[model samples]
Target: MNGIILASILLRIAGVGYSLVLLKRSGDRRFGFFTVLLTFMAARQVLTVAGTTGTGLEELPGLVVSGLAILTIHYLDRYVDEEHRIKRELKDTNEELTIFKKAVEHAGHGIFVTDPDGTITYANPAIESVTGYEPDEVVGENPRLWKSGEHDQSFYEEMWATICDGDVWDGEIINENASGEFRWVDTTIAPVTDGGEIEHFVAVDTDVTDRKERQLRIEDQNERLGRLNRMNELLRDVNRRVVTTTKRETLEETVSERFVSDPWVVSTAVVDRTASGRLRTRYVTGDETAIDAILEDTEEAISTLTAAVDHGRTMVSEQVKALSNDDITGDTVGVVPLSYRDRNYGALVVVTESSKLFEIIDHELRTELGDTIGSAINAAERRRELVDDRVTELTFAIEDADAPPFELAAATESDVHLTRTTTDGDGQRIVFLKVDDVDAETAMTAAASISNFSDPTLVSAADGACLLRFVASDTLADTLACHGATLEALHVESDTGDGEIIIDTPVGNDVLPVVEALSSRFDSCELVGRQEREPTIDTAEGFRGELQADLTDRQLEALRTAHLAGYFEWPREHSGEDVAAMMGVCQSTYMQHLRAAERKLTTNLFGDERTSDRRPAVA
Candidate 1:
């Protein structure tokens, strides 16, 4: 064992000596010195172990030193690896920072960095595009130099207030460039903090002047289109009302009401250019106080109307002031002539207090309106003459068998309240009325109530309801009538039942008259339906044919049977079963057939859509 241990020690000493020599040759002085120390220690260990070099206690310190040397070398190797790793990580961090700087520099939107004092520290090329000031010039300068003066100082205070609070500030702002032209930008500014204190600010902005201008133009166009659409709707209403009425007063009233309803119009007044060459107020509505003064101002209203009548065209008065009425304000006005076939009926004047330009309200629309009114007036006059030539003074009373509506019953119960009705070419009259619910005392006074309206022949009346027929100025039982129109319907229901009249004006007459008269009477009137039907030669056979045409063979048979059985009489002379037996059919079947026939006939005759109010379905 001793010889083996001695050989091991000798081999270690020789190895240490060779290592020192190798290290010295390599010019590594530190490692060479370490190798020499190790060689001397190894020699000492060999002698001490053999008890020929030193005592065990004396060699203890050398062993301790050797162990510490090994530990230091291992730690030094780990430290070298850690340093390499740090270098690699730092290289990666530097590369990432370079990429971030390049990205900001090439960004399309303006980018700028500022110190805590708001002094520009860095600016990208995009900022140059925005302010027309290069980075070299903008650096160290406050962004206030590019202020357009568009915003007040308070706006800047708010911006700083937001950014300084560490909250991001984002919104649109206007600025001036080097050329002194205003530029709009959408911007965002954010604060960078160090140790919970704001250190700097980074601002990003995009140019949006072009986009903003485009948006404004689009809004303007939409406004113009909206105005045109509204005007078209108003004109359509006028045209529709002129469908069944041709009364001059009616036309004027309709025109006035529609014009006033428009948002652009402050007031409307219809003035007539009478045959005596005098201006007379016809119909006026909306802000009447404002219009009355303007109308009384002879120079403003009369002069404008005269010009319109003389030129036979619409006249526009801009910024017209009424000197006659001191309290009245000035506004833009339009006067259109109502002329037909070389005859002038009147002039319609509309005033607008709108500050917006009136160019959008086309002149052509006003002219069309004037022509329509003139035509209606002319038609009314023509129909009157025709009615006078055809029918003598007479009245056709409603029969008890033909039931009138509740409103009609109330009107019939009052002597002052007369049920005025007119019929379509098919000899059908539908009258809607709001009357005092009295017990059957009103008179059939269509002829007396209206100079031109046809008298209705009462078909049957029962249970406070009656069905009457009035066909164009030739009463159902001998009456007179004329031209007509349809109205933009209005309905109001209150303590008084609604009186809605579905009048059939004479062929070619505007329906405006019926709507106007009914509205004046009931405070609310609505048109049921209107057709552009021409007046046909009055004949009972034509009316009968119209009803028969809509009925099936079975329906006609049932209707004929029911009439013969006196089923149309008040209190129904016979039961439905008896009538059905007379027709050799089940009672239900007969009633169904009868109701179908009645529905078709009433719908065609009165333009009444109700299936509940059976109009005694008899021919």
Candidate 2:
């Protein structure tokens, strides 16, 4: 029995210790009840082993203590459970707070936290890098240090109000950094509230300065490209007219008209220097009177005009409103020089009142415009020279004096080309005749109808013309010495007999006796033109009467038409196709007429034997 009691006591003690350790480790209320049960068994086992019997007072005290101990165990277990729950919740909260702090510190965007009064409390490393300020410099300072003047006071007030109202604010802001340079940012501000009142503000900002700058640059470049394209279009439209015009008057008129028609220009004029060095107004359009008014009022305008021709450079003059009238007030006049191949012709003056419009006419653009006009002038001048160099003046009429019938032959002067020269063959005199503008059929008809020559040997009859080799005896020179006409001097000949002849005469020589002698051979004769021109210089007066011609009526008309229509220079300054179009003829036909007139002119000047005597032909 003693051994049993001792073993029971020891077992009970071990169970109580184990239960206490479980309660401490697991914080389980059930483990505390097991500890209390073990304690009561240990107490009862000790009392029974001591041979103690259950008495009234002693047992009652033990029972009360036991009851108190049981109650203490139950409440102690619940207390431990509640304490463990609180510790777990606190640990989780602390872990979450640590994660949030690290996130804020490492963020790429600038993060700043401010107190309720807008004083900066914390600035992340990113905020310091973006604002050019260290954390120490920004903390405790107001965000006003970063404000840029781009936004008004009202903007900041509204932003602050939104944040203070426990709301989030998002916007773009231009701020100045520590370097005194402005930066753009996309920013969001959130108010952090505690105790039902706004306590702090948190801001996240992303640097967007580079993006904004790129956008602005792209817009500017696009605008400039559009402007350049428009200018090129205008230049192309003007150049088309410049290339086709072969006359100075036409070119000037076109330029002035086009310029005036543009919304920019008010008036325009072309001032050319005459060969004598005098300024002449060649062409004008769109309030042309303004040019005259300017010339009369401002001596400087005349100087500028002279400078344009003498220096062959562009010049500009401005007439303020005080010096100008309603017709042309506050005009910015640009005198563009007309020069080509280092030759100066004159100035093309353009005027406008708007300064902005004048800005569009840059130096390079003005030069190109001048070059277009200059090229046209150069082409026109060359054509004029070609026409003027061939001028011929003479008169000739012929009829048979033998009372024999002469056929009044007729042919287009333009359709016939004749060339004659005197040559020697085998110690004998021969006249070479090359008749052109004839096809095989025309050659046959001409050969059948003409009895003027003997022994005509056909040389070559091809390409709508004929080359004939003629065999003439020495009697050719003596056969018609009285006729006094050389092969090369036969000019403007027509079957209807309306043509002219050249006579090389000194100033005092009387041509009446020789004319009378020639008239005796023909039934009648009359002089239609005469000219004793001296050598000419490059002047207006020198070039006058440039078309002094003794051409047949048909030949004269052809030459005149060629000159007026610029057929001489039409179709891009060299091709006369346009002249053919205007004259209602094929290009070949028109060329035929023009070449015939030119041939007749060349012959009359140097081939006519009458002119070799140097005597004037008089009626």
Q: Summarize candidate 1's per-residue lDDT along 1-619 as a digit string, tens digits.
A: 2444444455445545555554545444554655666677677666667654333455445555665554444454456457657878999988998998899989999999999999999999999888889989999999998998899999999999999999999999998998998999899999999888999999998989999889879998898788778777877888888767666668778778877887778778877644234556778887777667655765765567677755677888764666234554437778888877655666777777653424765677667778888888787777674764321111112222122333333335432222334445576654433233233224355322433234545554454544344343323211112222322112222234343322334443333333334433443334444454343343678778877877899999998988898999998999999999888889999999999998787676654423323221211
lDDT of 2 by residue, 229-311 (tens): 66566677778888888777788888788877766577788886542345677788877667776566577777777677567
RMSD of each: 23.8, 22.7
TM-score of each: 0.48, 0.41
lDDT of each: 0.63, 0.63
Positional deviation of 456 in candidate 2, in angstroms? 55
* Lowest lDDT 10-residue stretch of candidate 2: 403-412
Task: Please state the error at residue 446 of candidate 2 in Å.
Answer: 64
Residue 292 of candidate 1: its Cα lDDT?
Answer: 71
Candidate 1 segments whose C-alpha is farther than 4 A from its true place: 1-53, 56-83, 149-161, 210-219, 271-281, 289-335, 341-347, 351-357, 381-619
